[model samples]
Target: MTQYEVTETSDVKGENCPMPVVKTKQTIDQLAEDDVLEVLATDSGSVSDIAGWADTTEGVELVDQEGDGDVYKHYVRKTE
Candidate 1:
């Protein structure tokens, strides 16, 4: 996985479903434009959830996603 210059990191390690995506959105909203957010999550569902959310949402981009067993890492960027 390529390293990203993340402006913030949101750890939702044990959280599941909406919590991961919800927290990601909230955190991303607080970031400056072009800032990158690194989201660490343990729930496997977050892989697809975050991607889907980013895909449909405006001003947010899903830069990258990586998974290692139960741990998942998502890099999201604030485009606006």
Candidate 2:
């Protein structure tokens, strides 16, 4: 069986674009393979930024996503 763990979570509500992305990257770097990270951000751009980052970057997998009101939640898994 495969085990997934929540390694980190960031609530970047009211924050800007790069901040959320930057923080997400920092958290992802600390995670081991298959570890999950849930990031909450209010920036609308975060959806694309984080998704794009995961798709473009190596060793990162975007697992899930949810958005409501001004908050966007992104679940990412580290693969490398």
Candidate 3:
């Protein structure tokens, strides 16, 4: 199992694009190695963006994802 912290959340209920991805990255960076981060976003694009970022990045792991309606949650584990 992975431990996660809700580092940041965006109420971008009506926002779109880059903002969601940008904010998610910002929060992911704040966590320590092996620590997981949970990001709350409202942008649909974040699903691909966040997953892509973790898959392509060398030191990040996209652990899981879940969403309810407009709110999307992403879990990322940092790797050193």
Could you tell me every candidate's TM-score relative to the true structure? 0.93, 0.88, 0.77
Work out how many backbone clashes candidate 2 has.
Answer: 0
Instruction: Name every residue pair that clashes in candidate 1.
Output: none
Candidate 1 lDDT score relative to the true structure: 0.94
lDDT, ranked from best to worst = 1, 2, 3
lDDT of each: 0.94, 0.87, 0.75
lDDT of 3 by residue, 5-79 (tens): 654444545557877666667776776787777777778888898888888888888888889897988877778
Model 1: per-residue Cα lDDT over 1-80, one tens digit each: 65569999999998989999999999999999999999999998899999999999999999999897788999999999
**TM accuracy, model 1:** 0.93
lDDT, residue 73, model 2: 93
Question: Could you tell me the lDDT of residue 34 within candidate 1?
Answer: 90
**Model 3 residue 4 lDDT score:** 65
Error of 2 at 44 (Å): 0.5
Candidate closest to the true structure, highest lDDT: 1
- Greater TM-score among 1 and 3 belongs to 1
